[model samples]
Target: MKTILLHVSLVLCAVSSLQSRTWTEAQTGRKLEADFVKVQGDAVVVRAANGSTMQLPLARLSEADQTFVKEQAETATKPATTAAKTEEKSSGKEDAKKALIGTWDGYMADSDGSRHGDIRLVITEEKITASNPRGGQEMGAGTYKISGKRIDATGTEGQFRGKKYEGIFDLDSKTLKWCSANDNPNSSRPTQMQTNPQAGQFLMVLEKK
Candidate 1:
């Protein structure tokens, strides 16, 4: 009986020692040896014996390492997360500015020496609408597709006209030139005249508004 009791105590001590030096994944409930874990600021940088490093949230660490890891995580995540957020914001701004969202003045001249006069284009998030100030008439709304520097607009041309025209508007120079190709179906001419088939192709020139 004495020998059996001693063996049981030895097993208990071994189990306790093992538990003290290990960590378990809170989400998946998987256990990992503690010696393989390293505490790097706000991030718990873990390096396995095999030499692979994985960074995790500091909160995921054990209580004993929490204090030190929390501080490190804060410092490390701040700059990294802030930089990631800044990059996302910059990407969004570029996307919004890629299209001609504001108002634009446009003119189209036909091959017959007749000009269609000046027109105002107002593009909103939902649709692209245009109007002719001379007649105070709405040109109806249509959908548009804008690429890096090219714009293809298609919309209603009012009661007497059809609603489809593909043109390229270059926003860099604030110049817009498009043609009414829907009216003349047989004409193979380019829809609008511009230096490039792209929009936003001109050099960026900005002044304080």
Candidate 2:
């Protein structure tokens, strides 16, 4: 009876030690709040609310976050990769294809937190339209496509003057990001533009109406 009691106590102690170790590792390994900023080739850029940016391996993130990072990274790394592949197999132009066919509202901001704007995207089967409903400015006409849950759009009518604009819309969530050409004849010249030339990339968070 004494031997059995001693063995049972030993087992309970071992189990408690294992559980404590597991709980400690989990607490340390857990990500508090992460924002997927960008992808540079094989690395993923994530920004935490603490204002620290980290470029980590794509495999380190959770499954859902990994998928989001992969899609964003692929889109950033290979411009027109999807369009080229799809265009070769399909007879129709990819621009005429509409993947962002819905209403979206979001907040727009540059790399710097100074300048901000509100955006609305109205997409149809044939066209994708966006507007700054708050500023009373029209973003103009565009074409869009969805690749791996991300929406890629190229504006034909020019959003800032005559500058051509392209955007990657995350459909799984409400993130709208776009970059406009710097030296397009249709786009406003750098000297006349309000935002910095280097800050042409617009990142916005969309709210559903």
lDDT of each: 0.47, 0.48
* Candidate 1 TM-score, C-alpha based: 0.40
The best candidate by TM-score is: 1
Identify the runs in model 2 with alpha carbons over 4 angstroms from their true place: 1-99, 113-115, 135-137, 149-151, 158-164, 174-199
Using all chains and alpha carbons, the TM-scores for the candidates as numbered come to 0.40, 0.37
TM for candidate 2 is: 0.37
lDDT for each residue of candidate 1 in 50-119, tens digit (9 for 90 to 100): 6565665545545544543333335444666789988997776566555446776555443443454656
By summed lDDT, which 10 consecutive residues of candidate 2 come out lowest? Answer: 15-24
Q: Which residue pairs collide, candidate 2?
A: 105-206, 105-207, 106-206, 162-186, 162-187, 163-186, 163-187
* Stretches > 4 Å off in candidate 1: 1-99, 111-115, 156-164, 179-209
The local lDDT score (0 to 100) that residue 107 gets in candidate 1 is 50
